[model samples]
Target chain A: MRNLDEDTITQAVLARHTGAPDARLREIMTSLVQHLHAFARDVRLTEAEWFEGIRFLTEVGHMTDDKRQEFILLSDTLGLSMLVTALNNRKPPECTESTVFGPFHVEGSPEYPLGADVANGARGEPCYVRGRVLSRDGSPVPGAELQVWQADADGFYDVQYKGEHGHRARGTLHADAEGRFHFKSIRAEAYPIPHDGPVGRMLDALGRHPWRPAHLHFMITAPGFERLITHVFRNGDQYLDSDAVFGVRRSLIADWVVHPPGPTPDGGRSEQPFYTLDFDFVLNPLAQD
Target chain B: MRNLDEDTITQAVLARHTGAPDARLREIMTSLVQHLHAFARDVRLTEAEWFEGIRFLTEVGHMTDDKRQEFILLSDTLGLSMLVTALNNRKPPECTESTVFGPFHVEGSPEYPLGADVANGARGEPCYVRGRVLSRDGSPVPGAELQVWQADADGFYDVQYKGEHGHRARGTLHADAEGRFHFKSIRAEAYPIPHDGPVGRMLDALGRHPWRPAHLHFMITAPGFERLITHVFRNGDQYLDSDAVFGVRRSLIADWVVHPPGPTPDGGRSEQPFYTLDFDFVLNPLAQD
Candidate 1:
């Protein structure tokens, strides 16, 4: 208990928390309080500005519901989501790098067999995606689980469409004995995240666009390896240089080969122009329990 | 538009606001983004911790309504409200110092005449408060508006009582030509801020008490001078050393003299024993229009 001045209040607050039951919680709270105070002092935050922040946060909270999470969107737009992902995902050079696990991934997507089309009732150019899951040593990891999802050409996920029950442009697939997996879906499209909320308003006020680069969301897991959540961005997408969520990486970007309506790279026939996108993912070993 | 790494994301976020129409808003936002990112970096904040913060903020938002504002409470407990008050109320040494104008003040309180008791329908130890509002040169400032409010002996403001109305223990008053003002109320009682919400949970987790020092709220305004929002804390209160809001200052503390049943210091006789509190407030000269 002390009459704390601006310079001493941070110390006083920290001292009060010395008896916290959890050491990690205490450490986290101390750092949080220090930074929170520093931020306020650094800017000499005004009462009016502080009130504005409170109101803005309340509005963001109110905007969140079953289909929307404005707070997560706020994190993404502020680059915190990506920064945390990078911090938690220090991997070997051969292992796939991770990105923001966006808010649209569903819990249980319908499983599909090899060469199945995931874009049911969705409209877009056909894209054939074939990938192999391997260990860091470049050996195939059979029975690896691949959970994949993406937005349609119209920039909305299957869950976003009203009255829609089935998952579109999303599916679960398994790697075979050779660790090979393939599926057909609509080409990934650069799309704006849900921008009708407070986060969208913030982006608009900042003169920033909300469009993410065209990419496929992937979460790969196998026995004796760490679960890897990553994204494979399409090459030459205009928004790649400025993905709204800052989720793109050079290694994750791959070329999409366009072929005439004929024999495909996997020996499959098609009537219209289709794309062939081939990539491989390497997983890092899981940590000891 | 660039793919940002941890080192570069702050600048990218700041650059997005170059086109803001309001210069002040732009400045505030740029500073906010920088500090926000710096805090995250300093803590090496994890995704789980970030999500916890989001959830805490969301709960705070849900707790706020027309009657409750947990965000303001959050700011007050964090010492931000007092810091901002101190920053904005820089005054000459002679002028009375200011503190936080807490959330309990109500607009259009019933005005009372000098020497009148403002504690109608409120129960507590009788206390007579006398003060003078003087200008820098020690001259009386007639008709300076003084808005005052405080909790009862039970540590509850009138607003907190269900079915209570008419602003008990609160009143508006005007200083006389001689700069004299006096009123009757109950002795200020140390009280815990509303602790049933997220802030309370945080305080409990940090092993901090939620009690504030006993005090009276005052907002003084004159036609020409800057408005002063402040508190007069009880000199010997137990919580003065550890006010939950960090709002106590040495200059604002004053002794409350107790008297047996008899003639009062102001020549007013009473059958019951009462306390007398005396103080003087010096107002800075009004800013030139």
Candidate 2:
């Protein structure tokens, strides 16, 4: 308790947490403190730098609210969110790999029947998206619920529009008995994550861009399978190799084929050039606990 | 860039920072990311736990404002502040050891002459504090400025009273020709740091107490000596061995001798019981470039 120098203070801190009733909590706090102490010691962090970190975190926190989650942005941009996703959602190679569940996701999105135009007046070239949900054994996952959302061509999600936009380019739908699902939406485009906050300043200082590759967000849930939250990135996007959040996975990329102004997947004629994408999701079964 | 598993994402993240212009910033960020990723992998951190951390940080940020800083409290309780203080203030064995510069310190305190009662309407047993500032070689450092502050009997700093109290138990003064400084204030008592925020919740979860030992804060500065920010802890305090901030050092402890109703240090009579404390500080000379 006395004379806690830099080397011994870590042990003293860990000793204080010996009484935590929750084993998991104790383990977590122990690892956190050890690594945190090691980090401070490794960097030989100075008082001024430490104060600057505190100020940066405070600014990040203040930037968070119901509409914006700057802390999650911090995590995503730092690749921590992807790392956590990778750790928590380890799946067989055959099953779909999960990625960052970005901060723009909203609950209670309107549900429509299969093949509905989920774009809802959002601007961009019309795109028809179709996918099938299957189990790891390659069987149909009938009636699986699919929650889809994406930023419009202008690179802004409906939530980022500040009440000027409705639930555009985001909706919930269900797969058919054959596990086939389709929806009409705008073409995805590479866009920067919500910058202009503390995280943005950090990225700018680091000389890193905040743009993520063009992608569509998906969250699929079935009765007996693990929930899958991932993105289907456009195959040839420029930022695909450098997705800002590190959310890109090889298995998740799909080609967005462009067609002449002709019949669309929805059996509707499009006067303007339209794009279509087809991909399949394989869900892993719930762990046998 | 693609197929980034848990093991590879760390390097990918670090590689992105290769272009940082400031070398120090880049180094700090590199260590931070490495330790952060290692901690996550060590704990096999789950998405739920990650969300909890984000939420906790957000709450801590929201609780902070111009009047209070919850993030600093978070760092202090975790012993990071103490570690940083120890790292930045590595003095010779004989020089006074530094401790956490708590958040309650305010600039522009009223200046008072030597031996003045700085406890302006604060409630506590009257105590006389006297000390001499000396160089590490034991020579007096005359005209050293001493900034002193302490919480009242109720464990509340003047600023914690929510504007109801002006300046109480805090003032700035200069040492005299012999480097001797004296002030009249209240006897220090063990008190809890401001809890009831997210940091408090974390302490409760860890089964740790938030109390710190009784001590008087002093920031001493002389012309050729390094700035000394430290505390003279009251001997025999119950929380001495379990300071919530891990700020206790054997050399910083001093005894507060109690006296019956009698003459005070300033040649005045005290009807109530009074306490007197005598301590000396040794400052290290500033390092040469």
Question: Across the candidates, what are chain A's individual TM-scores?
Answer: 0.97, 0.98
Location of the lowest summed lDDT over 10 successive residues in candidate 1 chain A: A1-10
Off by over 4 Å in 1: A1-3, A263-269, B1-3, B264-271
In candidate 2, which residue pairs clash?
none
Model 1, residue B125: displacement in angstroms? 2.0
What C-alpha lDDT, on a 0 to 100 scale, does residue B197 get in candidate 2? 89
Q: How accurately is candidate 1 docked according to DockQ? A: 0.54
Best by lDDT: 2
**Residue lDDT tens for model 2, B1-289:** 9889999999999999999989999999999999999999999999999999999999999999998899999999989999999999987899989999999899999999998999999999999999899997889999999999998999989999865677999999999989999999999989999888889889999999999999999999999899999999999999999999999999999999999998887999999899999999999999898
lDDT of candidate 1 over B105-166, digit per residue (tens): 99999999988889997889889999999989898989899999999999999988888577
Give the C-alpha miss distance for residue B89 in model 2, angstroms.
0.7
Interface RMSD of each: 2.0, 0.6
| lDDT per residue as tens, model 2, A1-289 | 9889988999999999999999999999999999999999999999999999999999998999998999999999888999999999988999999999998899999999998999999999899998899998899999999999999989999888865666999999999999999999999999998889999999999999999999999999999899999999999999988888999999999999999997878777989899999999999999897
Per-residue accuracy of model 1 over A182-238 as CA lDDT, tens digit each: 989989899999999889988887778999989999999898998899889999999
For candidate 2, give the lDDT of residue A130.
89
